[model samples]
Target: MAAETKQSCYEGSSVSSFQFYLERSGEHEAILRCVRDVLPREFKRTGADKSSLDVLGVGSGGGQVDVQMLTMLQSTNPGVPITADIVEGSSELSDNFRALVEKTPNLEKIPFAWNIMHSGDYEKAVQAKGNMKKFDFIHMIQMIYYVDDLADTIKFYHSLLKSNGRLMIIVEGEKGGWDTLWKTYQKELCVDAITQYRSSGEVIACAKSLGLKYEELPVPNQFDITDCFDPSSQTGERLLNFMTAKDNFYESLTPEIRSGILDLLRHKCSTEKDGRVMFDSKLSCILIHA
Candidate 1:
């Protein structure tokens, strides 16, 4: 028998480390706030009294945001049942999500079907089911970066919606500091065909080209990346790996290239405030209506 390789790089310590970074940087909080603010206004209630709302979550990580969205949905449509289809590629994340569900109060009100598979796999499964079901709400949060064809994926998700269904997508903005870093090093780091650094600007263009009806909002965010300047800092190295999705990313580069990148990050990508290096980490919230 052959060895079974891991499908996702988000394993064990890396997951927790990335979560720590997200927490410390307040990225998760900002995104949550943005979602809470927009979801109520953007989510369209179709057949509210006829049937339960079916939701599809692509690459839903760890169920934290999933629970939040579900709570909002339940609040919006009181006494309505919800069926959630959670598609996540990481086993660790899925397990954590299950645990979270167990601990979350009133989560039993919403039934969940967890699919430990990638988005492509979920697509195949849906196709194999002969399109028997359609979703009322669908969300893809910061997960399109791993897809091979972004536009096709978005279109496919849109196709799987019931009337008045809404698809929400979150991604980095073009003018954000992370976007500058990604554009500079994407060619070098993104060797995998499925992996690419994309911004909401590109997504908006794609949606417009497809003639899709959409609304977009900006989620202003920031992160302290000062640790990334210290070459000897383990947290710095881990943060770089998290950002670039490459192992030993900072160490692999030539000293000159590394120095140049560091200088760019310090001067162009980040601003020093109260002795902390704060990066301009803005996110985009895009809602596509079906």
Candidate 2:
């Protein structure tokens, strides 16, 4: 992943990482294929009498991916109407997403509403209102790790879903990469206040503990990390910081720790070919019916 300066990668720092991952890994296509393949059944399960579909997007950054998913839903359902409600904490990101929506050709046709608040805040406000709106579909991608209680959050969202509604969760895969790196050095590297290393495996385990059944698909991913090898590159260091979920990781690193991390990244996690190192950041997506 490429990076701009930020305390943590997940804190709305660089869209470059997302764009790069989508470009190289084709995760967007994989996700879209899953959506296309499953939505037909979900829509049918939702019943033919519904006049419109209520879709909730949690932590939908910049709206690029959410818009595409909405488009897919609209295309799949054809005549069925869609109402999109998005929750995002960053006002700037929400504004940018709104601007994107304004320029999008047919997306203007969908009814869109943005709630500029953190997911927890949104949940609190809605619960305070005492009239929870049930949704036909809800998607929380790459943001589950931010919550305090994973199982509780999952259960809360499940409660808000209609009988046949579907909830989609996308998270880091537990196959390799940081999953391996963190095993040895998480306490040193993951120094953030919220340093939960919850991955798809944890999510699946939590789901089972809650007695919720789900189906999932793996989304294999890779990132060009050749720049990370260049100590003189500012982007390289920033990307390292993001990778570690720590601020100033370069300056804070002792020579021994730095060498250890780099060695692990190169040999234990990443692959080298044609003078470029590719970091495999595999992800997984799961679908559950309420």
Per-model TM-score, in order, reads 0.92, 0.87
**Model 2, 1-290: lDDT tens per residue?**
21111223334444554554456555566566666776666666674678888999987777777877777777768788788999887665677789988887678878888887777777889889999998999998777766768888898888889877889998778866757776668778655534566778889998899999798888777777677778998777766776775557677888788889988888878898888888877778888779
The digit string of per-residue lDDT tens for model 1 on 1-290 reads 00001256366776876686676678778889998888886553553554578999888877788888888887788777789989888788888889998888787877888888778777888889885568998988878777768888898999988888888988887778878887887766566533467889889998998999999999999888899988788888877766655567666777776787788788888899999898888889899989
On lDDT, the candidate that comes out on top is 1
Task: Please give the distance, in angstroms, between residue 199's alpha carbon in candidate 2 and its true position after superposition.
Answer: 0.4
Q: Which stretches in model 1 have alpha-carbon errors above 4 Å?
A: 1-6, 44-50
Candidate 1, 182: how far from true, in Å? Answer: 0.8
lDDT of 1: 0.79
CA RMSD, predictions in order? 3.7, 3.4
State the lDDT at 71 in candidate 1.
Answer: 80
Best by TM-score: 1
